[model samples]
Target: MSSSKLARMAHVCVLALAALSWGAKTVTYDFNVTWVTANPDGLLERKVVGINGQWPLPVIEVDKGDRLVVNVHNGLGDRGCSIHFHGMFQNGTNEMDGPSMVTQCPILPGSSMTYNFTVNQNGTYWYHCHTDYCYPDGYRQALIVHDSDAYFAHDYDEEFTITVSDWYHELVEDLSTEFMSLYNPTGAEPIPSSFLLNDTINTSIPVKPNSTYLFRLINHGAFVGQYFYIEDHSFEIVEIDGVYTEPTEADMLYISVAQRYAILLKTKDTIDKNYAIVTVADSTLLDKIPSDLQLNNTNWLEYNKNAPHPQAIVNVSDSTDLHPYDDLSLVPYDHMPLLPEPDLEINVTVYMKNLMTGYNYAFLNNITYTAPKVPTLYTVMSSGDLADNPEIYGDFTHSVVLNHNDVVQLVLNNGDTGSHPFHLHGHQFQVIDRSPPYGPGFYDYLNGDPVPYDPNNHTAFPRTPARRDTVVLPPHGYFVIRFVADNPGVWVFHCHIDWHLSSGLAMLMIEAPRQIQERVTIPQEHYDVCRAAGVAFEGNAAANTKDFLDLSGQRSQPGWIPDGFTVHGIVALAFSVLSAICGILSIVIYGMADVKNKQDSVVPLDNPNEVVVEQNATGQTKT
Candidate 1:
C-alpha cells in the first residue's frame, strides 16, 4: 500500500469511528410501577409489584459515566413506592436517591417521581422498591453498567446476566401480619415455596465450545443467601458488586442477598452434552422446605440441541450438594492494605430480640431502628437541625452523621445466630477485615466492651482489601469496611435480608447534611409526594404506620422560606437558577446534536491491511 492510500484509510476509519460513537450521551428511561399478579415459580399466585407490567421487573443496562434519568409512576392501589438503585453512588444528586425515610420521600400511590444520577462506576448492579417490606415480591431487577476497563477485558466472547432468588407466594402485607403476630412472634420468616432463576424455575443458557463467556450472577433474593455452581466447569471471578477483583478460580460460590459476582467461563470441547447451572438456598442459614417444593432451581448449558452427542460426554447432577466458598474472604486485584486510614470509626454489634414490637426485631448499636415521621434527608436539610445539634439526632433511627469527605471505618459484628447479608447504599466500601468462622481468631473479644463494641481495634487489617457494596456477616463473626463519605446523602446501611431490614436492622448515614443542602435543590415534586402520602394515610386510616409516617398537624415550620427572605423572593431566585440550568443544558444538548449532524466525506479503504480486525470478527484469512 502506498503512503497516501494508507493515510487516507486511517483518516476515513477515524471519521467513521467518530460518527458511530456520536450522540452517545446520558439515557433517560420512563418506567411504570404497577401491581401485577403472577406466579413466577409455579408454586402459587399472589399480587406482586411489577415494572412496566413485567414480573421480576426488567434489566437496566448502561455504560459507565452515563447519566441515568429514570422516571417512575407508582400505580399500586394503596401503597407508596421508591426504587433504590442498589449499588449506585448518587454523589451530588442526593435528593434523587430513592431510599424511603432515609434519602427522600416515597412516590405515593398514583404519583410519579424522577431519579437522576450519573453511573460513575460499572459492573453488575440492581434496583428495587425500598418502601415497606414488598422487596420479596417481583419488584427487584438487574442494573448493569459496562466499563471498558473491566478486568479480563479481551478474554470473553459474550456476556450474560443470571439472577437467582427465593420465591414466596404470599404478599408482603399478609406475610408481615403473621411474621409480626404473637403466633410467630419469634419472627420465624416464611420459608420459600420454591427458588427461581430469572423468574423461572429453570432458565436455559446456550453456550459454544472452546469460547470464553462472562456470567454475572446477581442474588436478588430478599431473605436467603444462595449457593451457585455449574456442573464440571471451573470459572474465574473478576468482579464483585461494582469493583473488579483479582481473578480467583473456583468451582462454586456463595451469593448472598443483594450481592453480585462476575466470572469468566471457559467452555469445554464437548458440544452436545448439557450441563447443569444450579442454585440452591443456603440451607445452613435458612428454613428448609420439602425437596419436592421446587427448592433446587437449575438452568442448562449446552451447545446444540439438535446434534447428537457421544456417550463419552459427562453427565451433570441435579442435586444441590456442592459446598460454596465464603465469598467475603476474597481479595481485590489492587490489594494494598494501607490505603484506607479512616478519619472516623463506628462499631456496631448486630443483635436480634423481642423488642418494642411483638415480633423479633434486629438491632444495630443497641437500637432497634425506626423510620422517623420526616425523612432524615428532609429533616437534616430543611432545618439544618441535625447538623446544628447532632446530639438530638441520636434516636431510634441510629444515625451516624459525618462531616463532608470524611473517611470512615465501620466495624460490624454479628451477635445473632443466623448469618446476615449487609448492604450499603450510595457507596462501594472497601472490605478491610473479617473474623474467622469458629475459632480463636485475631480480634481480642474477651478483653473488649461488647454490645456497643470498641471501634478502635487494629485486629486483622488487610493491606489490599476487597471492595464491594454487599457483604455477609457470618454468625458470631465480624467484618470491617472503610469508605469515604464524599457523596452527601442520607444513606442506608442495613442487612440486605428483607425480614431484617423491615424488622429494624438498619442505620442512617447522614453524610454532609449542610453540604447536601447547599448543593441540592429540594424539588417541589418531592414535597408533593410527601403531602400526598400523609393525606392518603390519614383518609383511609388503614395503612400501616411503617408504610408512611403520619405527618399531619405536627407542623414544625411552615414553608421552606429562609429567614430574612420573603416567599416571593425565594421563588424568584429559584426560578432564575432553574432558568440558568435549563439554558446550559439546552446549549450542551444542541451542541451534541450539531456534532451528530456534521457531514464528512470519507475516502474508502481500497487495499489490504486497512480493514479493522478484532479477534472475534468473522471472515478471517491471509490476504
Candidate 2:
C-alpha cells in the first residue's frame, strides 16, 4: 500500500477506536433487601430481593461525572430508612449527606426517595441505611466510582466482589421495636456463629490454568474484623478500602467493618475444579475472636488429600477486561495532607458489662481485669500529681480535651470479647501502631503468660504506618492513630454500628478554639419590616439591616486593626526612597566585605608572571 493510503487507514482506525471509547457511559442499578422468617434453622433471615437476592446488595460501578439516581424503596414497613454514602464528597450537597431525619425526611414505609447525585469520587465508598438498627439489612450496597484517566485502569482475567456480613436470625425489630432497644437492657439477639462471605454462597471463581483473578473485598459487617485467604494462593493486594495501595503481596489482611480491599491472584491450577476461598476470624488480634468459626469443609479431609493441585469450581474465561476499574487508586482530597505533629492524645476505653449483674461490670486496661469505675494510669497522671489522690479520681474524665489547632493522637483499646470497628468523621487518620494482648503468642494473654514480642529482627510488622479512615480494633487489642483537629464542625467519632452507638457507647468529641461565629449580614430596612411584624432590633435597627449595613459600607470588623496602623498599610508606606537607599547600602557593605576576605586569603599568587590565574579565557578573574 502507498504511504498516503496507509496513513489514511491508520487515521480511520484511530477514529473508530475513539468513537468506541469516547466519554464514559452512565449506569444505574436497582436493589432491594427485606427481612424474612427463616425455616427449620429457627432464625430470622434477610435475603436480597431485586438484583441478585443477596444481603448487602451488589457491586455497582459508574465513571466520574456519571449522573446516578438510586431510588431506595423502603419495604421494611417497621421504620424509616435513609442511605448515607460514607466517605463520599457530594460537593457540599446537603441532600446527598443522607441524614435520615436531619438533612431530609427518611423514606417511610410504602414510600421511596430518589437519591440523585453525580459520581465524582474514585475510591472505595459504600451506602448503608442511616436509620434505626431494625431496618438495616435492606439498605446496604457497594457503589464504586471509576477513575477518569484510562492509564490507571486495571486488567484481570476474572473478577468477583466479596461482601462479608454478620447475620442475626431475629428481626432486629423483634428485639425491640423502639430504636433504643438497640442499647436497652435486653440482651442482643443471638449473633450468628459463622459470618457470611458473599451472601453465604460457596465462593468459587473459576480461572484458566495459570491465569490471574481479582477479588474486590468489602467489609461492612457490624462487629468483627475479617481475614480472607485463598485455599492455596498468596494474593497481591493492589487496593485498600477502594484506594489503590502500593502493590504488596500478603497471605491475609485484617479488614474492619466499613472498609474494603482489592486483591489480585494468579492461579496455576486448572479450570472446572473446586477450590475453597477460606475466611477465618482474625482471632489472633488483641480482641476476642469468635469461638465458633465455620470453615467450608463439605468434602473435608478426603478432598484435601487427593484434590488436584490447581482446583477450580468453574471454567474461567479470558477476563482481561474484567478489572475495568483497577487503576483507580486513592487520591487525597485537597484537605488531606501529611499531618503535622499531633497535639492531643485521647485514650478511650471499651468495656463490656452484664446489665443484669454488677460483678460482670468491669474495666479493661493493660490486658487485665479491674473495677469498671477506676481510671487508667494515663487518666490518673492527667488528673493531677498524686497517684492515689482523691481529687484526681473525683473530677477526672477519661475523655481527652482538644483545642482547635491541636493535632490528636487517639488510642483505642478493644478489651472486650467483641471487635469494634472505629471510625472518625471529618478527618482520616494514620495508623501508627497496634498490639494484640497476646503479643507474639498463639493465644491472647487472657489465657495466662503470653509470648513476648521482640523489639528487633521480628517479621511481625508493627507500626506499619499508613493513612486510613477506618481501622478494626481487635478485641483485647489496641491501636494508636493520629490526626489533626482541623475540620471545625461537630464530628462524630464512634463504632460504625447502629446498635452500639445508640447504647451510650459513643461519646462527644469537642474541637476547641471554636470557630469564630461570622457576623450575620442583615439586609437594610428589612429590620423595619420585621419591627412592623412585632420584631425588634438594637441600635439603628433599620440601618443595621443587611442591605443598609452593606450599602453603608460599615467595616466588617471595625476594631480589627487600630484606627491608622493597619499591618499591610504601614508596611507599604515604610518602603519609601529612604528605606530603599538603606537596604541598598546594607547589601553593598555585605558584598564588599565578602570580596575583601576572599582576596586576603589568596596570598598574592607568588610572582605575577608565574601566577596560577583562576580566570576565564578572557583573562578576567571570575568569582
User: Local error of candidate 1 at 592, Å?
Assistant: 85
Runs in model 1 lying further than 4 Å from the true structure? 1-24, 306-322, 334-337, 385-388, 392-394, 437-459, 535-623
The best candidate in terms of lDDT: 1
> What CA RMSD would you report for each candidate?
27.3, 32.9
lDDT of each: 0.74, 0.48
TM values, all candidates? 0.77, 0.56
What would you estimate as the lDDT of candidate 1?
Answer: 0.74
Cα shift from native, residue 199, model 1 (Å) = 1.0
The per-residue C-alpha lDDT of model 2 at residue 9 equals 99
Q: lDDT tens string, model 2, 156-211?
A: 66666667766544455654344333232232423444566555534444456676
lDDT of 2: 0.48
Poorest 10 consecutive residues by lDDT, candidate 1: 536-545
